[model samples]
Target: MNDQRLRLDLAALADEVTAVDLRDRTLRTSRRLGIQRAVATSAAALVLIAAATGTAFAIRPDQTAPPLPADTPSVTATPTPNQSPTPTPSTSADDPSGAPPSGGSGTNTPSVQFGKLFYGPADVTRVKTAILRSWRPGGSTVQLLALPDIAFKGNMSVSSDGHRVAWVDSNNNLVVADADGSGKQQIRSNVDPYCVGAAWSPDRRQLLFRELAEPGGPGRFGMLDLRSAEMTVRWWASEPAACNAVWSADGRTIALTTDYGVTLYGADGTKKRVVPGFSRDGWSTDDVVSLAPNGSRVALLRRNMGGGDAGDVARDLRVNVVLDTRTGKQVTLPLGGRTLRQVYFQTDGSMVVRVQAGSGYAVLLVDEDGKKISETAEPASLKDMQILAVVD
Candidate 1:
């Protein structure tokens, strides 16, 4: 299980691995500029950090991440509903109770498309906006402001000096609530309905999550430790299953990409480095590793085919790999979009993902060898009043 190749220097083996290599050295290859592109994968040549000290995305081949010919947010426009999570600083909600966690306390909610706080990537000089939902237990700031239906799905994490913010609530629990939701608490709960978030710590305090239990089940998946207030698990199964998570940016190492591959968990939890094949349903470890505000490297969207010949999955998509979460090594982006439920990872590796198209998806922001930088169309009015709880 060894890809053999080695040079080892990922910032001295993941400490924020940096040697730098992204100053634009010339590119252009949607197939020799003939442009029939889409259906790609296969890459190498890593290390790049100097846009002062953080950045991603810059693929070329006449550059084409296409497919925004514009169908537009499906055109009905309706985010202005029952809104009021407190801070319209900007950002997400989805489930309004369909019956699930009966043990009760499920209060830290936010889903229904989800949003409670956002505004990430802060360090090149410190630019922030990180608030994101929290605060329920004693009532004075962990801010969960509304909590009724629960929202703020994924990506908006911060740590390398952006102040704080590490998401995931609704019923999946595992919160840190501050940087906006102010003082709210919990530190842990049932977790993983597909759980894919809660990463912050390289000094932001402590957080990282993942779980999948069954193989011999008794509970134990991968990295889990919030440090103070209470919660502490970090049990990377030698058995059971379900484990995919990431957290680096000084939170002290916690990378776990599994279905069975890719791992790194120190900060005192142990199990460092199992990563050889890495796959958590192909690519996407919850909130997708994408770190780098000084925590040093980890930007993965990954899933490529782009050498084409598989035809028709909606006109055949070809390439979209972007790994290097500390030397798994990869880089290629020229997509056509197919399944992608959500991606979001910016600071250069580039991405805003969620493409289903035609009848639904339209959130494009792809780049970093994948192209198509911004296509947002609509979904911003916030007027009604029932959005209930997204307070950052």
Candidate 2:
């Protein structure tokens, strides 16, 4: 946990941060009003405030390349939906090969090789290794822990309970270490675990892993039951839809999406309802946004039926939508991205959201109707860091 100073500015569009409709994923603001003061997106049914800064955006491969090289991304983007139309929350955002976007003039920095970063306790940089002599930082007084062999490279994922952490080491081993960096046990796998990503059950007892037991064998799907220490492979490819397996917090039905749309399945693989029109149809698109404690109201990233943000990329697109999961009838809100990620709802139906904005993340406790009450950050040590979780 290097005490490196991370300074970010968000003084562009200074306005009172407030409520956003949870129906669409668009904003109701503009980028020309200088730097944004702060965004107010919440964890549950949050909205966005897209303000395109003059700063270079990571140009898509399909988009016309910017003359200047790209810089280290301050953001992560999901790969574009495959042309084949598969359903899954866990698909690589790029193409079928799971590649990152291609565009470079030596300045293309995707922040891939700096090392898997995380909020290490508070902010302390000290380590005592038994492997080698005293490891030190670049002759500077600042403390550093450089365990080259114990590499935690690639994508790092923290469990929902925030206790265990799983990441791929340089050797492609799926390693689960204690949040306090104590017990480090490596799970066996040949392919990089981070490549396909790993999903821990709500109880963290089982892992729904995507792998092949043998090189020439078929891709394996299903549970690595910790309780029994057994591997129960399912007869499903798991992809072309997205999620490998998403267990309910209590560990019951696993809801997933396929090439067509979202579906819920029993623990024994009994197919439930195939959520309709999650993909684009008649100008409507929906994605499972949340699973409340009661499992009654499932939040969705719902796009409008007849709306376009062609001219206003910042403020004229889709909004968040909340659905009564039991019945298909839904209630749409005009939420935007800047504030969508700010909203957070508990299993008890209570929610909190950030009221102010900065490049650095800080959560604000809000009232029921999306009103801000306080601010808190998502425990991190980097600058402008927003944590995105991937469940395979």
lDDT of candidate 2 over 153-229, digit per residue (tens): 12244454444555544344566665445566776564223222345555566656555334322145555665665
lDDT of 1 by residue, 58-166 (tens): 1100101222211121112112212333332322322222112121211321211211212211111221222233211112222222321112223224443333444
Residue 80 accuracy (lDDT) in model 1? 20
TM-score per candidate, chains pooled: 0.28, 0.45
Cα lDDT of all candidates, in order?
0.33, 0.34
lDDT measured at residue 196 in model 1 versus the true structure, 0 to 100: 35
Candidate 2: 10-residue stretch with minimal lDDT: 54-63
